[model samples]
Target: MGAEAILEKIRQNAEEEAAALRRQGEERAAAAAEKIRAEAAADAEALLESARRSAEELSRREDLMTGLEARKNALAARRAVVDEAFSEAHRMLLALPAERWEALISRLVLEASETGEEVLEVPASDREKYENGLLERLNAALERSGRKGKLTLAGAPGKMEGGFRLVGPVYDVDCSFEMLLSLVREENEREIARLLYPETRAAGE
Candidate 1:
């Protein structure tokens, strides 16, 4: 072949090689771009899922907190109602007639006397009742119970609303109205709650 023909052939071969290289590069770039897009889509989906889970968890916690707060408020209200009921009962007991109180006092003294020789501390407001044969009746009751102890009135009047305190040699017995009511309340708290709030039992059921 001639020199010019050979050169022309070489130029044609070079052009074909360059075209092949360009096509290969374009294909590689397209593949890389597609891979990046797929990875980005997967990352975006994962982020969205994480956000949804976080939101659900937060909502659940808020709901639990709200329920707890509601229960606390309800318990406080119930306690207030129970306290008010006990207060009213105390007032009624304190408003009893003088004769009724005298009878109650005699019974309480007899029940509270341990050795029968205890100083009976009466309320300062009702000291006259004890001076009028009340001590005699208490001693008679103690005699019937087969206990040997002389009962006497305390020189210092007791500070109380009602009821008496028997000051014994070793220990003192408090039969005061306030103390008695408190004892009764503590002992029968559950029963009182059931009576006052029927809904509590119903809820338990």
Candidate 2:
């Protein structure tokens, strides 16, 4: 396929991946949240019942302690759901087929290229992939877009497990899958937490 067509495929794949992530996160959260809610409610009831049998001061302390612990455990469980979603995303990205993988990294490289002449630093495992024709296609895309179009693939393998980096004279850009996914998680963490425990969020608000 042509450079533009590859880029378009990359965009479509990105949209699909994002949608899949949202669905996986929502499904996991929905599944785990209900179980946690019921368990927490039951535990709270049992704690309250036991507290009632204690002296007034002791009952108050017990209630406070148990409530704090319950909140801590609930928060932990919710965080786990968010963690699993990203883990699945990482898995899916790594598991992509060769064509899709080429499309993705190509798109990322094109976007990250500031001058279109930066050296492409790919994972050591993928050197042959880029050397084969990836760099030429990227340069073609860059030139077509009115950039320098002098991009070259690095001989040494990069440190990133997945994704590539653009090494420019002034600065470098990291487009590693790890950093990208972390950025996604950082931006949507609160929103994901709320989704997992909407009732708690609503009560707080």
Candidate 3:
């Protein structure tokens, strides 16, 4: 072959080699770019999933808090109702009659007699009636019990709130209007609450 032809062939071969290297580099770069793009897409998907879970959890928590607040409001309403009922009951108890009061006292005296020695302390709003009949009835109760105890009537009458206090030296029995009402209120507080505020019963319970 001629020297120039040989040289030309050599130059062409060199150019082809350079062109192949450039193409390989380009292909590798494209492949790397595709891989990076796929990785970025996967990362984005994971982030979106995480965000969705967080949002769901927040929603659940909000629902729970809302329920709790509703229950608290219901409970507060129930408590108000119970309080009002107790107040009314106390009022009625205070309004009971003298005869009723005397009967209650007699019964209490009898109960006291069962335990031990009995002394009755009677308070009547009507001092004249107390002086007239209260002592006599209480003494009769003691006599029926087959035991004797002194009866002391509060000197001042009618001005005091209704009820009697029976003391047996050591143990004391209270049958006053206020005391009886308070005892009943404790037992029936829930019932009263339900009657006054039916809607709040579930929350209160």
lDDT of 1 by residue, 15-120 (tens): 2221222222346435533553343333333222322343334444444655767656544554554555456555655665777656666666665566778898
Clash count, one per candidate: 0, 0, 1
lDDT of 2 by residue, 8-119 (tens): 3234444333222222234643553344333333333222221222223332343455577775655555455445555666766766789988878777776666678788
Point to the candidate with the largest lDDT. 2
The C-alpha lDDT values of all candidates are: 0.55, 0.58, 0.45
Model 3 CA lDDT for position 95:
55
- Candidate number that wins on TM-score, 1 or 3: 1
lDDT of 3 by residue, 20-107 (tens): 2222234643553355334333333332232234334444444465577765654554455345444554554455466654555455
Order candidates by lDDT, high to low: 2, 1, 3
TM-score of each: 0.54, 0.61, 0.48
Model 3, C-alpha of 135: deviation from truth (Å): 1.4
Clashing pairs in 3: 125-158
Worst 10 residues of 2 by lDDT: 1-10
- For model 3, the superposed segments whose C-alpha errors exceed 4 Å read 1-77, 114-119, 122-126, 154-160, 188-205
